[model samples]
Target: MSLSYENYLALEKYIESFEDKRGSLIIILHKAQEIFGYIPEEVQEFIGECIDLPKEKISEIVNFYSFFSTEPKGKYEIMVCLGVKCKKKGGYAILKDLEQELQIKDGEVTKDGTFRLKSVNCLGACGSAPVVVIGSTLITEADTEKIKKILHEFEK
Candidate 1:
């Protein structure tokens, strides 16, 4: 997607707000992502120029973090926890069910762009094992049937 003039202006304003500009690359990138939805090539290049860092370095940081997305994500991001507690509580089964029902594997966005499926290490809610996070809502003690109902809520 083409970067709008207003977005570039906003990013520039944010960069100029910082005096030191040291140890702010991640923050800048986060702001850029917030502005652009995802850090496209143009945004990356713009950040590189603003921070005087190589695009490769910026790209590396972006790629290393699961929170950062190079591509636009779905409106609803579904994160299934696969940590030990969750796995023991049938997290993998839940993930497989979602993949089958949505016809999209992990790290994939559905064709309708309504949902993005991802498997995370943990959601830090072990007591609520087998949790599935949809956007900011947490589905504790998640099961296949419960997941279907929750997905329908979003589909509507």
Candidate 2:
């Protein structure tokens, strides 16, 4: 679906806020995600027209980056870091536990829309390998027990 009128206008307002600034496109893109939750094809096209950047370039940024999502997300985003370090340290087991606990598979949001779980490339916490980040919180040492604890906290 396309963006609502207020959402489109909010993006336009973000564009105006950065009219005189350099690197406005990136800022606009960020605001778009914040306003719309996820940047879909149509929203990227609208952003392109607003900033004079091509649709391909917009898509490239969103697609290449792990932080951005092309689809909608639940209120709480559960990102399991699957980088080499995280993997070797038992990240998969943690992910498996999470999937079973939440009753959702990879790249799927929970039925109640309370959580969305997805694998991420890296979260730059190699020192604390096997990471699971929930929203803004970085959880180090992602194990089945720890993951269970984490899920319990969110259930409240």
Candidate 3:
């Protein structure tokens, strides 16, 4: 992992923010993610060292929380809603189409590192039904063609 000195400094500063080790793990992990996108095993090990905790504790917290991702995410995260409402309204086809178009499975970053495909339970917009959220933009009724168009807008 070999984090940069700046990142190391940032992590140290975050570590100092909380006096109680057990209470601050989540906050420290959140800052770690902010500094380093997603937390990898190496980062978790370093965090464990900082908190005087074992890697298993950190891994346990990361795995239990959906907000924490062990894998790397691309610059753009494409999430297709698979909630009860969206799924019933053709969400599966939309998700499958995204997987095919992106050439990657759910929760995987693309080879080019431009996009990551993911399935979400809900986006809080069931009225839109079949929603596809790319970055911060939410598209309603996202068919394959519409998904293509939306992705095009974010291409590097």
Candidate 4:
């Protein structure tokens, strides 16, 4: 499938709003990701065409940031923190439990495509160690049971 008509319109308008800006590449990438859910290769090509930049350059920007997802993510992307603080607070245990429950390796989406699990360096919420962010919601003080409950929320 292709991007919907409304998404195309939004892309055009967003591009125009930042046509001549000096340091707005990161912002542009965010807007693109919001419009397309994830920054697929084809959307990167369209962004390059709209801004008159090379596709590889757009690819570089996407690769430069960990926040941007290159492929299509599931309905829920669980971001578990693996920073120093988190590791000290059993983050690895939480991650291992999630891996087994979801039956998929880290960074891989489940078979039903309802959830995708990924690990990040830090969410800057060290005080709330062992944190996991589901979509835009952050869950701190997490453990195996907490993670299992959170994952159930994404279930039908």
**Model 4 / residue 17 / CA error / Å:** 16
Winner on TM-score between 1 and 4 is 1
lDDT for model 3, please. 0.88
- Comparing 3 and 4 by TM-score, which wins? 3
In what order do the candidates fall by TM-score, top score first? 3, 1, 2, 4
How far out, in Å, is residue 90 in model 4?
1.0
Task: Please list all clashing residue pairs in model 3, or write none if there are none.
Answer: none
Choose the strongest candidate by TM-score: 3
TM-score of predicted structure 4? 0.63
Error of model 4, residue 31, in angstroms: 9.2
User: After superposition, which runs of candidate 3 have C-alpha atoms over 4 Å from their true positions?
Assistant: 1-28, 63-66
Tell me how many residue pairs clash in candidate 4: 0
Candidate 3 per-residue C-alpha lDDT over 101-143 given as tens digits, one digit per residue, 9 for 90 to 100 = 8899998988887899999899999998988899999899878
Q: Report the lDDT tens digits of candidate 2 across residue range 12-64.
A: 88787774533776677777888888899999998888777889999998898
Model 4, 32-88: lDDT tens digits are 788776888888888788877888998988988998978767789898899999999
Q: How displaced is residue 89 in candidate 3, in Å?
A: 3.2
The CA lDDT of each predicted structure is: 0.89, 0.84, 0.88, 0.84
Q: Against the hidden reference, what TM-scores do the models get?
A: 0.69, 0.65, 0.73, 0.63
- 48, model 1: CA deviation in Å? 4.5
Model 1, runs deviating above 4 Å: 1-36, 46-53, 60-67
